[model samples]
Target: MAVLFSVIPLLLIALAVYGAVVVLRRSRQVSSAWSSGITAQARCVRSYTTTNRSGDSMVRTTLHHVYEFTTRDGRVIRFDETDGPSTRIEGDIVTVHYLPVRPELATAKVPAPGKLAASTGCALLFLTVFIAFAIFLIVVANSDSMR
Candidate 1:
């Protein structure tokens, strides 16, 4: 039983590490992939209305666009914007940063510089919370072992 308790915290730490790695990797992939910027006008924007099990509605958005581009690695990503609120905008002048390898995949869109930074900060904040929680669990479990 003690072994199981000890293992559980380690497992949580592992999971936390995995989550952090995934987020950081993705962030890096997106940052590195962003190649060029374009003057894209918003084509369409719509907010989503999601219903949960308890019948509550959640608001989300889906943005679309039509544009052209070249990749940094000569991937030739083309066509419209297909990402929503958090990542894309339509009918507005957007500076799109795309991956060089896959011209089709854009790493990010900064609607406004300030907002993008805020979004990145929020993601990092959540990552910190998860990691801290994982450490706390390990510490508590280890202390219990001494008694």
Candidate 2:
């Protein structure tokens, strides 16, 4: 049980580190993509499906495809890598920053930096709380066995 407690914390820290690294990589990539003129992004979409798991029904989403948005410059853009979840949505007129050479590889601009920061903070807080709870569970289990 004590081992579980310690392992939980290590896992949380590892996730936090991973998130930081991702953010850093994104920051660098976005900077290089920002050009002097307008860069367009495709209309992103997700296919919804209804499914039941363990008696609880829920809507599940999967990547359908991406539609390239045409700017005045007549350039088609899409994602260079499809591994990451999309940050855009249909009918969303998001500001896109793309590499001049590879317009397909682009990132949608966040409308509000402060709001995004707040959301990121909340996500981190939730992760921390979950980790704490896991640790508490292990501690209680171990102490019970000790008695």
Candidate 3:
């Protein structure tokens, strides 16, 4: 029981660190993509819906879209955009942003700088609260051992 209590706090700390790294990395990637990516027009080739059974027999349906675009160097690239505008249908043209060197990291929409900042701030705030809770758990476990 004592071991379980100590292990739980450590697990929380590990989770906090992992979450921070993931959030920071994603923020950096989006920032870089938004700042330096090349702009191109892509045409929606197909749109499809996928349904899956989530938890407790709940069904979740997701709409997926595939788009194709021509690079400046005369190369054609086809990619999937899952979180794109739901109103887009096949044959609709959309603006795409991608890095010249990493075209696979293309996005149909770049988030506004203010929105990105707010999202990162919110994620970090949650991580801070999570770490504080983990630290409180560690202190409680240690004090109990001392008594």
Candidate 4:
């Protein structure tokens, strides 16, 4: 029992570190793409709404969007995105950003700085709380073992 208590904190810290790295990498990738990628207008070719029942027996609806864009070399690419229905419709034009070298790596928009910072902050905050709680548990377990 005591061995589990001591090991859990280390594992939690490792997990927190891994989560932070993932967030940082994603932030950098979007930032780089926005700075170095090309922009083009894409058309929303198809869209549909899916309805399903949740575990709580409540019905939920999800909107799926499919888009197509032509590269500078006259190549057309089509892909699906799940960023929500928004106000776009079939045959509507949307802006897309893509790497010139690898046009398939693209996004509808670069993440805003404010939104990225807020999410990173939230991840760190959760990690801090989790580590603190794990340490507290270890301390309590050790004291009980010593007594």
Clash totals in order: 10, 0, 0, 0
What does candidate 3's lDDT look like per residue over 20-126, in tens digits? 89888767766776787578999999999889896988998888899899888988989886656789999999888777887766777655878878988999999
TM-score of each: 0.53, 0.50, 0.78, 0.64
Candidate 1 structure quality by residue, lDDT tens digits, 1-147? 656766886787677677767666655545554433432222333323333353366545444555444444444444554354544334444445654445455533553545544766787788778768867777787788889
Candidate ordering by TM-score (highest first): 3, 4, 1, 2
1-147 per-residue lDDT for model 4 (tens digits): 888888988798788878878878766655665766477899989988888887887998887788899988898988676654478789988888777776765666544778767877898788889878888988998998898
Q: Which of 2 and 3 is the better model by TM-score?
A: 3
Error of 1 at 35 (Å): 5.5
Candidate 4, residue 15: the lDDT equals 88
**Model 3 pairs whose backbones collide:** none
Stretch of 10 with least lDDT, candidate 1: 39-48
Better of 1 and 2 by lDDT: 2
In order, what lDDT does every prediction score?
0.54, 0.57, 0.82, 0.77
In candidate 2, position 122 carries an lDDT of 74
Clash-forming residue pairs, model 1 = 42-90, 42-91, 42-92, 43-91, 48-60, 65-80, 65-81, 72-100, 77-103, 77-104
Candidate number achieving the greatest TM-score relative to the actual structure: 3
Error of 1 at 43 (Å): 8.6
RMSD of each: 5.5, 6.2, 2.9, 4.1
Q: Give candidate 1's error at residue 103 in angstroms.
A: 2.1
